[model samples]
Target: MNKEWFNSRAKINYFDKGYLVICAVLSVIEQQSPLNSTYR
Candidate 1:
C-alpha cells in the first residue's frame, strides 16, 4: 500500500473505465449511424 503503487493502480482503473465508455459510445453511434451499414 505504497502511495506510488496506489496511484498507478488508480490510473489503470481509470483508463480501463474510460476505454469501456468510449467503446460503448462508439457502438451506440455505430448502431444509429446510417454510414455504418456500409461496413456491415
Candidate 2:
C-alpha cells in the first residue's frame, strides 16, 4: 500500500528483466563464436 514499497518492487522487476536480456544476448554471442565457448 505504501508508495515507496511499490517503487522498489518496480525497480526490482526492471532489474530482473535487464539481467535476463543481458544473459540472452551473451548466450547468442557465445553461440556465434567458437572462441567464447572455450571460456565457459
Cα error, candidate 1, residue 35 (Å): 6.9
Question: What are the clashing pairs of model 1?
Answer: none
lDDT of 1: 0.88
- Candidate 2: misplaced stretches above 4 Å? 34-40
Compared with the true structure, model 1 gives a TM-score of 0.73
Residues 1-40, candidate 2: write the lDDT tens digits: 6999999999999999999999998888788777577666
Clashes of 2: 0
lDDT (10s digit) by residue, model 1, range 1-40: 6999999999999999999999997898798767577556
Name the runs in model 1 displaced over 4 angstroms: 35-40
Query: What are the models' TM-scores?
Result: 0.73, 0.76
Q: Which 10 consecutive positions of candidate 1 have the poorest summed lDDT?
A: 31-40
